[model samples]
Target: MAEFPRTDVFSGPKKTIKTPAWEPGYIRDSKSGKPREIPIIKQLYDVLMKLPRDTEKVFTVPKITLVRYFQKALEGANIQDFRFHDLRHTFASHFIMKTRDLPALQKILGHYSPVMTQRYAHLTNGHIRAEMEILSAVWTPIWTPSEKSVPCEVQKSFVK
Candidate 1:
């Protein structure tokens, strides 16, 4: 994030903004050694748009200061064992849950291999349940209980 250049946040056609990888003073990229363009959500775009563009870099905050601020905020919110990088994981998981598109995520994340993106993929229980509900809608029941038939003991436990 410290290496993010202001010029990288480009506005494309249709008012869309994307952040291209910026690795200033580096030969083979900075973080992951892979550079890619990542589309920014409207909310993030709005926030970034509000930042003062005084320097060539978008964010003037030092890396250590930002880390300390994040740690303080996390502690204030009673969050534990969470690092800044965890936000990437959360974003990846939510993105896959919403779009179900791994290839797109792989490109956005700048992963050279799909396996790296697969490692980031995680499904929430709610998302799994929602998917199961969709499957249940399409499935045909093979055996349904008759009105006169006695419910099984196990089934009785589920009766409301």
Candidate 2:
């Protein structure tokens, strides 16, 4: 297998957004009772850290405010109709292209089934084709001509 060069640098914010002690019960856990961890991007962390802390409110800002902020950011970047959820899609798409480990990717993405990872399988067509080529070489068949066989003589007349 060919080795790929590592790309991309994580050089965003140094700030951290503290989650409130009490969150809505429904959003507390996934179906499997595992807690969901929201990754804090550097830009988002910087913005969040600058905001005044609100002890009274369980959440720092309303969902509408977050959506508006994301929309405005997308508009500024000249990206059309981009939503925050699209970030997850983008991560999955890029990861699939670079890595062949679907199970590990599925776990990282919190997908219940590896089948969910199949959506990105088409992105690694080059890798898949290369794998097929290797397999085809290993499993190639060898054919040889067969020798003619003599017919067996019947001895049924004496028995009758």
Candidate 3:
């Protein structure tokens, strides 16, 4: 299902996209029954601030027009073979990597169940190594022959 952002706001930095479009599609998620509110981070807030509040919508242009320009932007930046949906995926992936918070991402992506948002999870390739690092010091072996031996008191405990 496609969602359109709601421009009407009385106060606060939250924005919502409502699903179940007038056009039909496959069942998305049970959690997607209601609109999802996204908190505005500094980058988004800055862009919103720059946009003219004179209009109701943050974007004055039509969705197609914006997509066309976004394509042009991709071309300018030498980004190839990417669609608007790819951008959403990229954003979701990065957000999950940075936050490691699945529920938060589910809310942001408007997924009713985290299972949908899990599709966006591309944890760092080093995730395993990063976790294994905690055990590195523990397994170092205090008395490896090449390294100094432990103090006599420490060594005696091991010897016993």
Candidate 4:
């Protein structure tokens, strides 16, 4: 297996976000009672790699702060009725559509169960339909192949 670089990010200090005390090792994943390993994308890794050596935390911001920034970007893009959480939804939808790997996506998204990730399955249905249409266009249909005297096993394996 190829080695992948890891970025150690200190999510927050020894404190709770609700009442914020000296509670250690608590991040958003603590709510789910499980630790999650989120993958570092190339662009994020490149940007994070630029942080100074003395930096301990990768990013430290409240949800409201993130929402404020997201809203600004939304205004610039002329997008409406979009929340900060919608970004996560959009990413999940697209990831499922591209990879068609739900289990991997579930892990990436830090869902407790695969069922939690099923909401994105509907989005993938459209992708599957589009892919099937492409297959129909590129290769002849089953009826056409059968009429052309194609072998059943070969047709079932590749053409179908």
- Which candidate number maximizes lDDT? 1
Report the lDDT of model 4 for residue 70: 87
lDDT of 2: 0.59
| RMSD after Cα superposition, model 3 | 10.6
Residue range with the least summed lDDT across 10 consecutive positions in model 3: 20-29
Best by TM-score: 1
Per-model C-alpha lDDT, please?
Answer: 0.72, 0.59, 0.65, 0.64
| Model 3 TM-score relative to the real fold | 0.59
Task: Sort all candidates by TM-score, best to worst.
Answer: 1, 3, 4, 2
- For residue 68, what is the lDDT in candidate 4? 88
RMSD of each: 10.1, 15.0, 10.6, 10.2
TM-score of each: 0.68, 0.44, 0.59, 0.59
Worst 10 residues of 2 by lDDT: 149-158
Candidate 2 per-residue lDDT, tens place, 10-75, comes to 557654554443332312334465776434345655554455764533347887998899888888
Expressed as tens digits, the lDDT of each residue in 8-70 for candidate 1 is 343665454444332333222346545544566666656665677655443568889999999
Which model, 2 or 4, shows the larger TM-score? 4
Q: Candidate 2 — which residues are off by over 4 angstroms?
A: 1-59, 120-160
Question: What is the overall TM-score of model 1 with all chains considered together?
Answer: 0.68
